[model samples]
Target: MLNPKWESIIRFKCPDGEVHYGEPTADLKSARVWTGLDVWSLQPTDTTRHVAEILAPYEPTTIIGIGCNYKGHAHETGIPLPNHPIIFRKLPSSITSPTSLVELHGGDVDYENELCFITSQPARNVLQDNALNYILGFTVGNDISSRYWQRKDTSGGQACYAKSFDGFCPIGPKIVSAKALQNFQSLRITTRRDGEVVQNSNTSDMLFGVRQLMAFLTRGTTLPAGTLVLTGTPPGVGSYQTPPRFIKAGEVLECEIEGIGKIQTEFTEVNSKAA
Candidate 1:
């Protein structure tokens, strides 16, 4: 278990263009720099710096996405709830800054607001009850998707291809340790598209809780330290909406969790030749 004395941590750019890890203040405007090299054990020095820019918290060893794990999401899509967790892999290349732009490939892009958790240690065959002990911390992620490639008819039902594009997964603002959240359940999650609320739900809507997913994922599958798992998104994704609302180029998407704060992302169309 990562019993971090610090409540939160953030990787940010200093005024001099150097990058360092520090503890984010309440307003997230400034951070107290850490002198220690090891992030798991941070010793906050007296030095403090203004957050010139907030970067993605960690470059994960692996990015795992859970599908149809929310009851309302399942019901909306008319897909049956899984007896087992439905999981997919997202390449590390998809990782991007929490405040960065999500490139528009060909429109039909969808938004999924989810709770993301990172593992503290190698885990294989971990039991459900002890799963929490393996978690390092929690943060929210916006699992951006390209709908055309995600459909069964086009991509043979594989989600990785559509979801692995550059900047497809923009996660952070900062990371809040699991010890601080105490309970993952009952936390309110909200998503806004162009300043209008579209997804509003709670962590309670999850068909599989954090413990269940951690145990199931580590069943004979070793997840190395820093593995990021995006627990399923709640109901009200753009794909499952009536008439299916897709993202437009130059639009903004924001996903926020109750305690950990929010991440705002904008989308821009990328030309195939230039991409």
Candidate 2:
């Protein structure tokens, strides 16, 4: 019975190169602060002192990707519109912060911004009508893809490798409360590269609405609390462009969803030596 709308949590980096975790309060001036070496001298929270990689607000144990859930996207891909939600899984390791870098592995890496719904409770066989009840909140996600690895005869593409790069799934900034999105039936999603507007669409254009998407996913699977399901991206992907495109080192991708907030991440060249 975990309340999805309980106390809000903030994850921040401290000067000592450590990440601090705590509930944000009105008294806290800076959201992210530098405590310096004095961080070791500060008093601990009443519960327990944690001064390491601060746990993410939602420690997602699993993640799923709903593919081509948007009507426009399916048409662009020249694939038949799925009567049900098209889903895939992004490795939990892919999740990173807003300002983090999404590495371009010298391969054809493309950017696809998406809306992610985090689960609040373990659920299976949940009806679409009651889907909202299980949503904890929403966060922005970038589904970096390698088109070469994702293509198959006509259906059933491989994703585990192409979509699971170290920083391929940049997600965050904050998770807006579900209530904040009063009507998910209509949401505006936008993505910009550098300063040029790229993808822009509305959730209303989705071939499968959130409720139906959730129900379709839950039909045969037990979706646990902390599970994140990316609801797919709109058109304007680099892969489908006339000239063809791929993310290169140093490009910035910014995404914003109505009521959910914005997330911006840059691209960096992946070092094969370090990989």
Tens digit of per-residue lDDT, candidate 1, span 121-194: 88899998898789999998998999988888888877998899999999998889888987777899999999
State TM-scores per candidate: 0.96, 0.83
Candidate 2 achieves a global lDDT of 0.72
Q: Kindly report which residue stretches of model 1 are placed more than 4 angstroms away from their true locations once superposed.
A: 36-38
* Candidate 2 wrong stretches, greater than 4 Å: 5-9, 15-29, 32-57, 153-156
Checking candidate 2 for backbone clashes, the offending pairs are: 65-88
lDDT of 2 at 251: 89
Give lDDT: candidate 1, residue 61.
60
Candidate lDDT scores, in order, read: 0.88, 0.72
lDDT of 1: 0.88
Report the alpha-carbon TM-score of model 2 versus the true structure: 0.83
